[model samples]
Target: MPLQKSPTGTWLPARVPQSTITLAILLVLCSMVQSTTGGYDGSMLNGLNILPPYTDYFNLNAATTGLNTASVFIGGFFGPMAAGVMADKFGRRIAIFWGCIITIVGVILQTAAQNIAMFVVARVFIGFGTAVDGIAAGVYLSETFPSRWRAWGVGLFNDFYYVGALIAAGITLGTGKWQSTWAWRAPSLFQGIFSIMCIMILPFVPESPRWLIHEGYYEEARTVVAQTNADGNPSDPVVLTVYKEILDTLEWEKKEGRTMSPKEIIKTPVARKRLLIGMSAGPFSCVVGNIIASYYLTYELDTAGVTDSTDQLKANVVLNVWCLGCALAGTHLVANWGRKGTALLSQTLLVICLFIIGGLSKKYADNPNAASNSLIYGNVAVMFLFQGFYSIAWTPLLYLYPPEVMNYSIRANGLAFSQFMLNALAVLLVFVEPIGIVNIGWKMYMVNASWDIIIIVLIAVYWVETKGRTLEEIDAIFEGQKHSTVPDVEAVRKGEATVNLAELEKEVAATALIVEK
Candidate 1:
């Protein structure tokens, strides 16, 4: 169904039932823990790097520091290899529970590290577990929420990453003055808290209805749909409409003999296109010049003349706060500007910010005197501005768009592939960022801005709008069908909508035939 304007003249419905809102809140709170863990790790490391005790104890130069930081992504790189299969075979909840367990083990090892080797090894496990937990939680959020709430629910999941960052920043800042090794160890140990929170919350949350249906739990799936969408009124029109769409779409896919293999992701032209766009979320997020700010804030701040440790830590805290606000605003903007429009606007602004940052850094970074302080401050302001824009679109879209474009059959594996791409690029680029900043200075931003322009062109040419559509309805756009299996809920309730199932089946058959040819 097309979107309806609310009484407030916005695209949002006039009012959602309190029950649905409560459920959305609960699910978002639960799923957000995974991202919070990741955010904490990044921020905690950034904070640690700034501490004399941390650097002195580890004797970390640029190369070793890069390795220590990249260790998590290295573990993340291998995580998706098994995470996809586990999520599909075991269940999203089980995968999350086990992933958290692994993360806790890693945290224990990391907190008590005897040497750099042990620290690196512990981080690998943490990265691995985070990857597993993140993929399952991401899929769960996308598949479990009611259609109207899906974007906000999933978008908010990653937005809370900044919440973790903020918490870590505050904690590390509090611990920065400690003379003992506990200064760093205390933060490392705290990293396990988010995963533990996730484990506790999982028991109360419902499984993904799509996963339930795929596993032959039809009644359970229908009941979940009703509970989430219609407050447990099984016969509610919206519930019936959404339930029918899922059933019919899954049936059509089953009849077409869909498999869960990663190879299935590229079996046809449409599928290939979906893979490209879905996986693009990974590189788009990593290469957008945000990595420098995210992982190397201390280095960036020092270069920009904010060399005081307390001042740099304060900037980290403030930056996360700014990003959290912008990311939340971006989620709301998805309704008005849509996925494509929000992304374009964000990248456009990011490019402009990067150029300004590069110019200012060139002018003042090498010589941090009184007269150039304002320009240095401007450079710092642009860095914060760049992060804000990155958070606005990329943070939410990183998890939201990939799962939206993927169908049930390949959603798990496809997301795993996307994670694989993200971690793979991150391991390389995150490791290289400090070196780039050291060697090329301001030119690093210029290089990133140049590449970002290419991504903007690619998005405009290739990306499809997924706003205001249900998961099943989106399939129609790629399948060359004139109508979606989903009926308009309000119209159906008012006896104004008609569904032609036989015609839909024929269209599905024709599309399948085309793929076969």
Candidate 2:
């Protein structure tokens, strides 16, 4: 349906089909599995010997613990690259199905781990499985949903990752008192539950209609499109219009003989912009110092004199709750404000919080008196704000913006390349974060503060607006072709005048246009 303006002044679809909601939820669950595993690892830091559940369990020091944490990123680095090929060649359904299966095995090994080596290996498997899910779910959602529902679909998928994070924190808090290995191991086992849920849902999910069209499966694509429409009517103009757009785009690609392989995608300037945007997301979010706060919160808090494990768990839960809440808020913000606006606003808030957090933290570290307790409290509050603001944009946009901007032909490959860059940096930061915490302390926040400004400038200058536009229309924008605005998707569905792309292009080309980066 077309977008309706709310009293609050946000544009949203008038009605969304049951099929779209179901598919988005399933994808969100798939994405959640990976984030749950990440959350488990992050929360696990709380149970280490230094804190309350100080079971002296996993009696490891900073360097070793960091290595174990980095193992996930190591697996993540390779998994997406492999999944990209699998998703492109084998189809999104099969790729996510196997990814879930792999995750199940990883969770088992992690839960039953007899030693650090075994646990690390299991973590790698979990990372690999989730990375595969990331690529498949992202590409599939972007391809399946209509333009009106696209932003919300991607936003929910991004939001659920943090939902998994909150679940992990809650699990840790609940299990902290357990005296046995089960304390930490139970949370690891919970990681597989999301993957299991995804596997169950996959049987009911359809393959991407666009992928079907790209492979010349016209009948299959058309049927899927029809089923995806609000009334499930095959002859619905909404269905036919989208089908035609896909066909026209594919025909153009075939006529031009434009190769869309990973190498070729990079070689094309416009396609490469999609990859760069995707790749940039990871560094922007991770480098802003959230990674350190996420994985090593217990350590960070401990250094600030909040050394109790139970207290650390409480703080972690509160922080995660705030992050998750902001992520929920982001789903609307992204749709209302557009990606570029939301990102700019979010980054600005993040920079402000980081400076306050950094300055206060430095004071608390330099002087640990009761007077500095206020500094500690203030820093903690701002840290929560930092996470909240980060979630408002960076959380969803990191994954959402990339696929929206990517060409359908190479969507999976582009997403994989982005994931690779993200994890590559993750590996470095995950390992170095612990060391940096020990050596440099609160000054580390300053580093993130500095990067946030650069990231903001880059986004303002380079990010394109994708709000209220169809995937096909987005292609025209990046290709520098003039395409008339599609004011309302519901209008096209009703066989309105907006359905004709050729006429629309002619009209658009005749008028003076303004494009924003």
Candidate 3:
């Protein structure tokens, strides 16, 4: 459905320094840390998969592996909510900076871990720190950028996430030493360093303008928002318009009811549902896509004749390279088509692809190879297709949507709940995946594919259009059709709910102290 603008007229631009490149650089640098942290986890997933094979190295069994894997996710589950709350209680910069400290400590503990028990404990800290960074990245990027580039900025900030996975794959391949501890530990340590560096460097960048505004630091907020290079000062016209809107939104919000607060997130039905949908959508992507990929790494490698550490590394390199292609395709399609349409269609196509890949995998397993390696090659091709298509459509954007779905009140809480569900789903799937490969064989792929089909149905039925929708529009949708489809008493009476967060940001930032006469 096409959107109708409320009195706010959808998202309005907040002018920033002309040096958008500097802002872009800070955003990208932040993403590198995002990618690196994820890369560490991806490496662990791959390395741990192979660990079960070499009992002598880790002395790990299925039960231990389950505990270890689940441990990290369990940690990740709570960390986002905690970060979100702390972020609000304090500020974005402190929340993120402290997350780096936690991350480094977690990495050190994990690196020195002498047993699976120690490893599991350390993993929790890692999960906690990582979640803080990830959620903080989402909140930070959204609040930091102007509206015109919001989607692309989010996407671009997140793209390095996939790129991080590729880098981790390459690191694994380069080592050709998955049998050793460094195969996993080294990546974690390296990423920890990167995370810490990001925190240290963040001091040089400005704080979130909206956040500054929210605290009623109007002068500082204005100076930052209207900052420039030629004279490095705020221009008069820019200052006036920005100041006006800030007052406008605050007045409109008061005219409506109460000032927005996080506690009110679940107070109403629409707010409650928005929180649920927002949180679930992100981690849901992982439950179906990422966890499944991590689960089946070994089985796929074996099918491709990548049995040993060396060969397995080679297979990953191939998958990594192919995955980049798929990421590109997925991104291109989604950009033009819109998220819901693309997500539904991709999920539809994924079901079909999974059937083909699974069926081909079964045949390849039985025959191993035939007609000059045609069957295995075909299987590999399908696997690539599965990863590529899903990577593009399902990968980055799934992470994007949930956070976008909710407004400020319940954003963190919603994300926290969803990550918990997602982590739990991942744990079950991860455990089931290996067992399925050994016991159920190619039938498991059919199961995953079928499950996705069911999820797509859910998507079609309940999924709302989020692309191009402002945060308020999303909140309206989340508030549900009952609250939103017909205008509210206020919206009807006033002809719209007029809130310009852009202007609210100005007074909130309190730029008077920062701006020069």
**TM-score per model over all chains:** 0.91, 0.88, 0.81
Better structure of 2 and 3 per lDDT: 2
Candidate 1: regions farther than 4 A off: 1-18, 482-486, 489-517
Question: Model 1: what TM-score?
Answer: 0.91
- Candidate 2 least-lDDT 10 residues: 4-13
For candidate 3, what is the total of clashing residue pairs? 18
Highest-TM-score candidate:
1
Of 1 and 2, which scores higher on TM-score? 1
Off by over 4 Å in 2: 1-37, 44-55, 482-517
lDDT for each of the candidates?
Answer: 0.83, 0.71, 0.60
Q: For residues 71-167, could you state the per-residue lDDT of candidate 2 as single tens digits?
A: 8888888898798888877777778778888888988998888777887898888889888877788887777777777787777776776667777
Give the true-structure RMSD of model 2.
7.4
Taking all chains together, the TM-score of candidate 3 against the true structure is 0.81
Per residue, candidate 3 scores C-alpha lDDT tens digits across 197-312 of 67755644555555565566555555554542111235444333434333333333344453345565677776677776566576547645445555447666565544676656
The global Cα lDDT (0 to 1) of model 2 is 0.71
lDDT score for candidate 1 against the true structure: 0.83
Query: What ranking of all candidate models by TM-score puts the best one first?
Result: 1, 2, 3
